[model samples]
Target: MKDKKQLFLSFLMIVVLALMLPMSALGAPGNDAPPDPAYAKWGRIAVQEVKAKYPEDKVVDYLHVGRKTNNQETIETFKLWLEGETKEFGVIIDIHFDTDTEKITNIQFKETSR
Candidate 1:
């Protein structure tokens, strides 16, 4: 009976620690709440930052920002600024929309070749 009790306690401790591991690993020491994604500042920042690298007209498609089609609530499968003729934008920039604000978190150049 004593062995069984010890084994059960060990298993419970293992399970508890397993649950805690993810939480601890996922967060920084002082962080309590997850970041907010929907802030307007987020989207504005993406456009402003990417604009420095490419012209606004060069920006073909990005969520959170206004779309040519004027549609909202879309992700991934959308219009993308691409190489028209000059290969100027050979790689389409992927703009990540913040989950909380529906704003762009950042922009990254796609690795796939045009």
Candidate 2:
């Protein structure tokens, strides 16, 4: 009876260890790739405006060109690369907003090549 009990306990221990091994492996820490940066509200709106203005084209790439501030207003710029049925080009969009109110005052775009 003692030997039988010992053998059963040993088998149970082995089963438990086998089950836990995979869980531990999954939980172990390792290098994980960083998540991509999310686009800001102005950036999203710029993309939408571009799509609207060029319905036949598709935006392929994006770049946030940074921001500038003055006494009464702030300016944010973004560059977007687009692909059309006939050609590929880039656009620079400028968003001007009030510094105190944070309201958009103007939006402009300029097309570029390369």
Candidate 3:
């Protein structure tokens, strides 16, 4: 009877440890994950501008086309797809900002069918 009790206690200890292991892992910090890219800010601006320009349409998709940088300026390009009650279309937005100050220099938008 003593041996059986010892075996049952060992099994119970293992079960408790197994349950705690996952909880500990879940609580651990995720410091190793990468941060957001520099163009993330520009992407958000593009979306907002599109929403303001086409309030009747719903933004269905977004894509970061690319970025171009000169000595004093940087332009972040994005393509956003919008769906309206009548039709769907794409808008390409170019967000130009001062490289050092990160201030908006200009915002240009072009609409496309495809």
Model 1 TM-score, all chains together: 0.28
**Per-model TM values vs. the true structure:** 0.28, 0.65, 0.72
Best-performing candidate as measured by lDDT? 3
List model 3 lDDT by residue over 10-112, tens digit each: 7678779978876776675773434689789889899999999999998867889999999999999999988787777899999999999999999999999
Q: What is the C-alpha lDDT of each candidate?
A: 0.50, 0.83, 0.88
For candidate 2, write residues 19-110 as lDDT tens digits. 88767666757835445444387788889989988899988777899888889988889999897878779999998999888799999999
TM-score winner between 1 and 3, please give it: 3
Candidate 2 residue pairs in backbone clash: none
User: Candidate 3 — which residues are off by over 4 angstroms?
Assistant: 1-33
| Candidate 3 C-alpha error for residue 30, in Å | 4.1
